[model samples]
Target: MGSLVVFSPLFFFVLAIQMSSLMVSLSQEGFCSAPPILNAADSTAQPLYWKVTNPTLSPSHLQDLPGFTRSVYKRDHALITPESHVFSPLPDWTNTLGAFLITPAMGSHFVMYLAKMQENSKSGLPLRDVERFVFVLHGTVFLTDVSGVTHSLNVDSFAYIPPNSTHHIKCDASSTLVVFERRYSYLESHYTDLIIGSTDKQPLLETPGEVFELRKLLPTSLPYDFNIHIMDFKPGEFLNVKEVHYNQHGLLLLEGQGIYRLGDSWYPVQAGDSIWMAPFVPQWYAALGTSRSRYLLYKDVNRNPL
Candidate 1:
């Protein structure tokens, strides 16, 4: 990992209150347990795992982690899952680095992360130019956006933040959160305001047989940087129900098990697994087991190619 030497000189303003208490907490590793360790070295290893194994070699800045691979990324079977990092919630902040998962994408450059923080900890990330889309998969977290309004984000809690907005996050209990962030690309027509919501509060759009149901997390009325969706697929159902997409997708399977079609290959996927597909690549999905398959998905839309 040649890129480990360049850390952002300017870190966000966050003071991890319990330095001693924090180090001790890692031992408990409750629902927020660290990534599983691979006893052997992997050929597909990326810089992230290297840094995880060797923190002394870490660079101070945030950049493209490009961990895993450019194609399908299965968390459990990854040749290398970047070692999780403990840093500030915000990339610029150098404190309380939370253990993070980093993955690569095509159109937009995003090192996505799935973070778990202990209860009573405050994420010392100040809103800067970072555009972040956060989803709470487990537990609860309090999110304060640029408007100075704080919302309690629990399981299925989702929020979107535009660039240059000031926000803060503090947790009274242990929580697991996933963050998808990339530089904001501005276009007058695609303008959108901040969005804060939870799928629990939204109606599930479904068909008569309940074959497919979708929870639209981001507003599609006006296009913005990207769109997030939580889709539930009945067992044995396929996502290609006829419509395909011109938009690229970065997806994470939140629940259930299934076979996913990517380009020309089909791979078995389960909860905690992820996939990144390019625009126009042939793709579809089929749920497995006895229950409905659900996933929190992301897509880039509403902007023209530069």
Candidate 2:
């Protein structure tokens, strides 16, 4: 028989305090149980973990633990969160860190990545025969174009670099940018010019749904092989219908919370989430909270299926 060992009241109180401290530590480390999912359509519902917490975590630390993630990968679509991003070096990029979010390996026709550049860092020689688009997410940068004109870019500023262009990027401050690149698909007697603009200055085009709007980032002309657009949805608004289209998309949620349908599954998404949809994949989205939801969308355009 085991003997009864009486513990003092002081000892019990100390033990309770220790346990509480342990729980707090675990929660900070993201090892605690996830909170329950809130009702997607209830505007008054409390924000869930995916919406309120920082999604960016060191990839090395996440490797050993079973952490909660909304990210999913399928044959036709994928949802990527910053927690899974692994920063790596790209050739010719000096003092810059990059994490590729979409690539040909993921069955996408283009490559998109998040790049962080230290002050004075530069993106070296432009790729031969490839077009590039850059959107500034933070800080400032100076882009020297093929024509040797330097343009300053701040948050929300974007530039489209034409194919085989001799251009380079220099960080004026510590900066973060979203970059998209692909081989240019040439159109007979057509050519693309370098474009620079700020999203904030673009006029919004109202959609059939009064709550939805769009800002076209690139010219809608035969000379351009692809296009980027900013789509905004007011609170409680949703796509009129689920869409199944031939356009492959690489989208980055820029603001607010929403429920996104990719193929047969629906996911709760928020700012900083990236989604990739292969051609003909079914997709839709609805803004869930009180704030508006906006995303940068990319699709190949003005091209034949052949």
Q: For residues 105-192, could you state the per-residue lDDT of candidate 1 as single tens digits?
A: 2333554666656656665442455578888766778888777888988777788877777777777766667788767767666656
TM values, all candidates: 0.65, 0.80
Worst 10 residues of 2 by lDDT: 46-55
Best by TM-score: 2
Per-residue CA lDDT of model 2 for 208-280, tens digit only, reads 6446889999998999989999998898788887789898899998877677878766676777899999999
The C-alpha local distance difference test score for the whole of candidate 2 amounts to 0.80
Q: Residue 13 in model 2: shift from native, Å? A: 45
TM-score of 1: 0.65
- Whole-model Cα lDDT per candidate? 0.58, 0.80
